[model samples]
Target: MKMTDIEKQVGDFRLRIPQLQLEDGCIHGLIGGNGCGKTTLAKLMMGILTPDSGRIDREGLTGREITMTSQRPYLMHTSVYENVVYPLKLRGEKPEESDIRPWLTRCGLWKKKDQYAGSLSGGERQKLSMIRAMILKPKFIIVDETLSNLDPDSVKLFEQWIREIQEQSAVTWVLISHQLSHIYRMSDQIHFLSQGELVVSGPARELLKNCGEERLRAFLDRESLDRT
Candidate 1:
C-alpha cells in the first residue's frame, strides 16, 4: 500500500506524510514516542480514519482483507473457543474443532478453550485476540502494541508463529510499538515518526546503524540507555 501527500489534523496535532510505501509481504515497523501519531497513522492505513488530504492506495484490498489488533483487543463475553471461531462464523463458515484446536494449542490456550474469555489474564486475552485475527487469514494486518502484555516467553512464541505464517503466506504486517527491541527484531523495514512526521524510514539494520535524523538518533540512544 502507498500513501501520497497524506495529511490529517486533530486539534493541535497534525500528521503529514509526503510519500510512504508499505511493501507487500513484509513486516514493517511503525515506531514513535507517546502521542507521536503512531496510532493515528495506523488508523489511516486501516481506513478507520480518513486523511484530510491525500490518497491511500490499498493495492485493491477490501475491508474484509484487512485486520487490526490493539493492545486492548475486544473479546466476546463467550468462551475462548467461541471467541476464536467468531470470525469464521461471520464468514458463514462452520469450522470444525480441528480447525480451531491448533490455534488454541499454539497459544497455550487449549486448556482454557471452554473457559470464559472475560476471565482470562491480560496476556492470555492478547493471545486469544491474535488467534482470532489470524483465523480470518487477512491479507493485511496492523498490530498496535499487541505484544506489550505478553511475557518474554509468550513474545518469543508469538514471534515464531508470525514468522512461520509469513513463510507460508503473502501477508503484509504492520507492527506499531514503542518497544524498539521488538521492532528491531521483527521488522524488515522501519518507519520512525516524530512530532507527527515521518523522520526516517529504511531497512531496520540500516536505520539502526545510521539514522540521519537527530531526533530519532537521540530517541534510540535513550532507549539503549534504558535497556542498560
Candidate 2:
C-alpha cells in the first residue's frame, strides 16, 4: 500500500505524509511520542478516517481483507467463544470448532470459552481481542497499542504469536506501540512520526541503531529512561 501527499486535519493538528509505502507481508512499526499523529495515520490507513487531500493506494485490499484492533477493544456481553467467532459469523462463514479451538487454547482461553467475556481479566481480555482479530486471517491488520498494560507473560505470548503468523502467512501488519522493545523486536521496517510529520522511516535495525534525528534520539532516550 502507498500514500502520496496525504493530509488530514483534526482540530489544531494536521497530519501530512508526502509519500509512504508499506511492503506486503512485513511487519511495519508505527512509532512516535504521544500526540504525534501515529494513531491518525493508522486511522487513515484503516479507512476509519478519510484524508482531506491525496489518495491511498490500497493495492486491491477491501474492507473484509483489512482489520484493526485498538488498546481497548470492544467486546460483547457474551461468551468468550462467541466473541471469537463473531467476525466469522458476520462474514456469513459458519463457525468451526476445528478452526477456533487452537487459537483459544494457544491464548490460554480454551477453558474460559464458555465464560462471559466481560468477566475476564484485563490481560485475558486483550488476549481474547487479539484472538478475535486473528481468527479472521485478514490480509492486513493494524494493531494500535493493543499490547499496552499487559503483563510480561502476556506480552511474550503476543510476541510468539506475531512471529508465528509472520512465518506462516503473508499477512501485512502495522503495529502501533509506545514500547520501543516491541517495535524493535517485531518490525521489519519502522516509521517515526513527530508533530504530524513522518520524520524518519527505514529498516528497523538500521534506523534504531543509527538514527541521528534529534527528535527521534530524544524520544528513544526518553523511552530508555522510562524503562529505568
Candidate 3:
C-alpha cells in the first residue's frame, strides 16, 4: 500500500504526507516524539482515518488483509482461550482448543487458557492481544506501541515470538514503538514522523548514523540513554 499526496485535518491538527510507500513483506519502523503524528500517520495508512486531500493507492495490496494491533487490546468478559479464538470464530471458522493451544504455549499463556481474560496482568493482556491479532497471520499488520506495558522478560519473549513468526511467513509489519531499541531492532527501514510531518525516511542503521537534524539527533541520543 502507498499514500500519495496525503493531507488530513483533525480539528486543528494537520498531517501532510507527500509520498509514503509501504513495500511488500518488509518491516517498516515508525518513530517520533509524542504528538508528532506517528500514530496518526499509521492510522491514515491503515485507512482507519480518511485524509482530507490526496490519495492512498492500495492497488498493490490485493488478496490480503491489512490489520492493526493497538497498545491496549479490547477484550470481552471471557476465558483466555475464547479471547484468542474470537477473531477466527467471527470469520466463520469453528475454532477449537487445540487450534489455540500452540499460540498460548508460545506466549506462556497456556495455563491461563480457562481463566477470565480481564483478570490477566497488564503484560499478559498485551500478549493475549498479540495472539488474537496474529492468529490469522494477516498480510500486513500495524502494531502501535503494543509492547510498552511489558516487563523486560516478557518483552524479550514477545520479540522472539515475532522473529520466529517472520522467519516462517513473510508478512509486511509496521511497528510503532516509543522504545528506540525495539524500533531499531525490528525495523529494516525507519520512518520518523515529526510535528505532523514525515521528517526522516531511510534504512534504520544509515538513518541513525547519518542523522543530521538537531532535533532528531537529540531525540535519538535521549532514547539511547533511557534504553541503556
TM-score (all chains, Cα) for each model: 0.96, 0.95, 0.92
Best by TM-score: 1
What candidate 3 gets wrong by more than 4 Å, as runs, is 60-64, 225-228
Candidate 2 residue lDDT tens string, 1-228: 999999999999999999999999999999999999988999999999999999999999999999998888899999999999988999999988888999999878999999999999887888888998888999999999989878878888998988888889979999998878888888899999999999988998887877888888888888882322
Where does model 1 exceed 4 Å of error? 225-228
In model 3, state the lDDT of residue 191.
86
Question: Cα lDDT of all candidates, in order?
Answer: 0.90, 0.90, 0.83
Query: Over all chains combined, what TM-score does candidate 2 have?
Result: 0.95
Ranking by lDDT: 2, 1, 3
Q: How many clashes in each structure?
A: 0, 0, 0
Q: For model 1, what is the error of residue 61's alpha carbon versus the real structure, in angstroms, after optimal superposition?
A: 0.8
lDDT of 1 by residue, 179-200 (tens): 7788888899999898999888
Candidate 3: tens digits of C-alpha lDDT, residues 63-110? 337778788888889999988877787787898778888999987899
What is candidate 3's CA lDDT for residue 184? 77
Give the Å error, residue 75, model 2. 0.9
lDDT of 2: 0.90
